[model samples]
Target: MRLFVTLNFLPCSVFPSPSFPYTTQEEESGVIANHLTKHFSSSCYLSTFLLLIMSQRTLLIPLSSFFIAHLLISGAVSTTFTLTNKCGYTVWPGILSNADAPALSTTGFALQKGESKTITAPASWGGRLWGRTYCSQDSTGKFSCLTGDCGSGKLECSGTGAAPPATLAEFKLDGYGGMDYFDVSLVDGYNLPLLVVPQGGSGQNCTSTGCVVDLNDACPSELKVTSTGGESVACKSACEAFRSPQYCCNGAYGTPDTCKPSSYSEIFKNACPRAYSYAYDDKTSTFTCASADYQITFCPGPNTSQKASQETNSENTDTNTNTPLINSTMVYEGALSQNGASPSLYGSVLGSHVTAAIVSFTVAIWQWRQLF
Candidate 1:
């Protein structure tokens, strides 16, 4: 007795809809089937045909087992990363997959000003991305860069991570609870202004985050990395400069309770509150999203960085206060408001103080008249 079982599945085109969204379970299954059909041997297809010729009870057991195994083997949703360069000069972007995660197609590539590139990562892929500035080839055809070089002496970073003093965008996709965790880190130090914006995702903290300011302009004298022309290229962290256990968050200061933010770290925090200023900055730095693609932009715009530089300098004038130089919640359209107080907020505070003074004066006049 021949038993025929027909499996009905939606077409791949139906996926990525507004309601259904990207990386849904059905879409993953369909993608797996499509991939197998194109790559599987003809003998494999013949075996499936022969299985259909068996009896109803015998066919059901083996067919169900075969499908279950296929789904288990290739059932992960892929994520796409879009990298764009808005800097005036060319940027060589590098990618480094985490120890356990698989490598991507191209580990590193060049992106000219106003250019963009997209790369796809398999499910559960985790890695870091950064831009290499001042890259060039010498007489021997050896490649290298001034900042954020992976030390591979080649275009592709392969498995090597970016050297310190590079602004990094780190990601762990399809993480806990099927959510993606990402952060723009200045912990390793800041070389360029980087921003990570999630596309078509939903979460409370899924908003944009990064160091939009040009730290090189406002970088402290001790932590500044200068080029051959004496121009500041990158800013080094206190940990990188001093190599102390306290600044590195090691030894006695290993735990969060033990290690605390220092004056140097506060400088970075005051300038870019959304970025990871030090090793232990997690509360406000880390962001999460679900089923989304990410757009990583280097030097989002020129005006944003210029305004941030002015604010940072203004804040540095007064170092006695504990209050943050930048309002943590203040959001300007395209730039960061790093001032300790916004103009509107400052006006409100001043108005309240003036009213209190007038009330005291009126009471004093009344008392003097009564005494007379």
Candidate 2:
């Protein structure tokens, strides 16, 4: 997803409160006219000043609406992320918030076969979510997964990204252009098949993106993550397998021109055409929408329709009770969050600076008119 971080001015002086009838400019102008007419008794000056006040008032309505519209639009809207596990076995979903961003409720949670869980992401939240396969908890409460284990040794990721060879669903909200960007990324690697679908959003290329192919079954021997039973559990990225500049796309080979897709990434790209195969794969993999909820499904293929009996688990998760089917989806309501606009979109960077200037200008007009 596109990451957007901007600092812009809030037009506080432009938008007056409902209780205050006149806008800042109009109020200042009226006060000045009243003072000048009362003290100096300057009828001609008062007439000219009132005319200017009338002109300013005429512009207030449309300008007020414009600023108000922007204010509403710029405010952050909560987005829902619904995670479903369609695999035959249980899957533990791991969440890692971006550095310095607020964490979602329960960084790690379990979903039985065909079960789903929902989480509300606040505004401008950037994070990655991945499923852990074949997880087991010891008597000491130390949990570990054969695939996508974040090394936390517990269900909670605790603000840690998944290890290599794990399929990842990444997102950043209120991104550049005021759109939410999301994508299924294999830049790290692939464990289970997954998909990210946008719901009720408007924009180009807001379509679903995922890797339906079971890369583990077809993983190359050199990049295979094997289980205790000697079966391939996940497919490791070339960078993780080789740690070379060509595979990792680092240093001298960081540029797109220098770091062309290797045979391994090409395999991933071929399997998942709409997912990120390499570090530079942005144009095709990245998807954006203005405001939309998303469904992230693991193992989202033909066999996904099969439902296994829900097993008794001791984890406390708000299971998707509305639907008994494994493939059913749920939407959650989130609180409103406000995001700042890019200064480049307008001219000012600091909202306080703009407010100060407007207040100063208004005071100057008030004082000058009172002196007359």
Candidate 3:
């Protein structure tokens, strides 16, 4: 009798409509339920039904708990990134997702002055984005850029990361403790002013962060990357410029304690405090947020050009004092409001989810014994 009942009811509730689509977390759950129904045979249903019947009323509790736990683990929220070009010149943006993350829609695209493009990413995605400057196609239809080039020889970088000497905006969405980690890094180098502003997110460290000052004009002569026309195109990091283990933070200097910031890194740090100047500069440079979209802008400030010139002029004068290279308060006032919750909150939230899963599994096991 128990076997008969198990076989009859298993097909009824376990399988769902095969037509169900999956995109968001809720839809994905529905699809999973549907898939289970379609694949399981009547005998399988009977076995499940017999177990449930023998387990009595308590069996439903664990089964339901298992489904809920599954949903919590599998469901994910997507993130959107809007790329805007506020520069006076064109910027070709390049994207490279991490090896484990899903690929984005486009790896590279052109953004003319005052243009914007939006890209959507699936949950738990991680990648870096950067701008390419002075790009042009040769007579042979080969594409290339002077700075931040991915060397793909085409518009799309595909899976290639940006070449060194380029400012980078890196992101890991839905990361540790259900929080998103983001930062603008100049550790590779600096080619242009970049800003990352989180939207619709909350976290104590969640705010706008980037190297907004144009460092090319005021870049140290030894570290400056110049174009063929004698234009300062980008700034190279101490590591890239010298390749010393002390500067690269490798070999004997691999540890954080040994890898101290150099004079060249200090120049970038003084100019852009929120951006990563060296490999170990994480405490001040990294930021976290929860449930947020992001806006990435090239040349963000209104008086960017004038400010660049002013920064260049003031660089030599403020060599002794601790004054930052640019007035961040004036440049970041309206759009760069810094406010949010701490990362610990996200950790607690994740802990609760994990606890719930463990409890659900335990309850199911105990109930199974009672039923048997």
Candidate 4:
């Protein structure tokens, strides 16, 4: 291409300049134009090189093995987190208890060293940036990953051959009008892996206003998001009491120890800053959790951290002022005069004090209502 272009330009410069002396300036200008075109074309490609610098690329073959190894280990860690937090077990409401727990043990599947099985990934892990779990060695120098990559429903979970077989579970709540959106609190990273392939609403970009976007982003106030579509997300409210370095899954206070963010922090802040609630869900136009369970109980959450501190202080004051009076038997005797005796001053004035105390007690309790 260069040769041809040079050939055309040279002839114009040579032939026209030599044979037609009057055309010398025109040929010179033509030569400059040709040079300028080539220069601009080269400059235009600078962006391509800039892209190469901005995007990372390496000896990928060597790193592929490393990435798979990380996935194997991360996958095991993921499974551990999944069961304890992401994985759901039935709970006794109001009174906190895991009465309805998963079976203690089961012999279903295990991955051995150098062994591999094809496995289907969770709803997340469906984008160009995210990598799928591969059929590789398991962590702990023991077993391998799924026989094939994660996509098909073939592989089994591994645990470095030291851990027991993993148990998977899903947690979800129904929405008002029965329309459902996956809970951000239940999934691993709010099932962020969904963004990779088939899980990410199938490559659909969720925005602030579009219906397609609302399918995932439209959380209102009256309806909060805790669990969703068989995945674990953030739901700390029902679980957290007051703030003490508690970790939240997505929006709700999560299982006591894990903290996973669903998307960019700012994006999450913009959509949900105060809490993950039913009213916060813009879909139904409410700002709270869908289930009464989200509200009826006084669950602790991010907000509760500060609120708890205030409650503790108030409780201490109440204990100092009111508990002694209630504990005093002297007051009880004043209420029940001895052997039908005539009303005494102790009974008359003290009885009036008790009634006044009850009224004051009710109002004091109200001062602490926000803690709930």
Highest TM-score: give the candidate number. Answer: 3
lDDT of 3 by residue, 269-308 (tens): 8888888888777678877777788999898865443211
Candidate 4 C-alpha RMSD relative to the actual structure? 33.8
Give the Å error, residue 18, model 4: 94
lDDT of each: 0.63, 0.62, 0.68, 0.19
Q: Per lDDT, what order, best first?
A: 3, 1, 2, 4
Query: Would you give me the overall lDDT of model 2?
Result: 0.62
Task: Give the higher-lDDT candidate: 2 or 3.
Answer: 3
Task: Assess candidate 3 and give its lDDT.
Answer: 0.68
How does model 4 score by TM-score? 0.18
Count clashing residue pairs per candidate.
Answer: 0, 2, 10, 85
Tens-digit per-residue lDDT, 1-372, candidate 2: 222212233333233212211111111122211101111110000001111233233211123323433434444357898998877668889998766458898899888878999999987677788988878888999988878888888789886667777888877776544556677888788888787878766555556788765666567899998876676778888888887877776667756777778889988887678888877776677776656888888867654322221334543232223322221121212212223321222232133345434544454355335534
lDDT of 1: 0.63
Q: Write the per-residue lDDT of candidate 4 for residues 263-297, one digit (tens) a residue.
A: 33223334332212211222221121111111111
Residue-wise C-alpha lDDT for candidate 1, range 282-352, written one tens digit per residue? 67777766567888888774533221111223322321123224535534223323453323322432443
Clashing pairs in 2: 76-337, 76-338
Segments in model 3 whose C-alpha atoms lie over 4 Å from true places: 1-51, 54-76, 305-324, 327-372
Local lDDT at 32 for model 3: 16
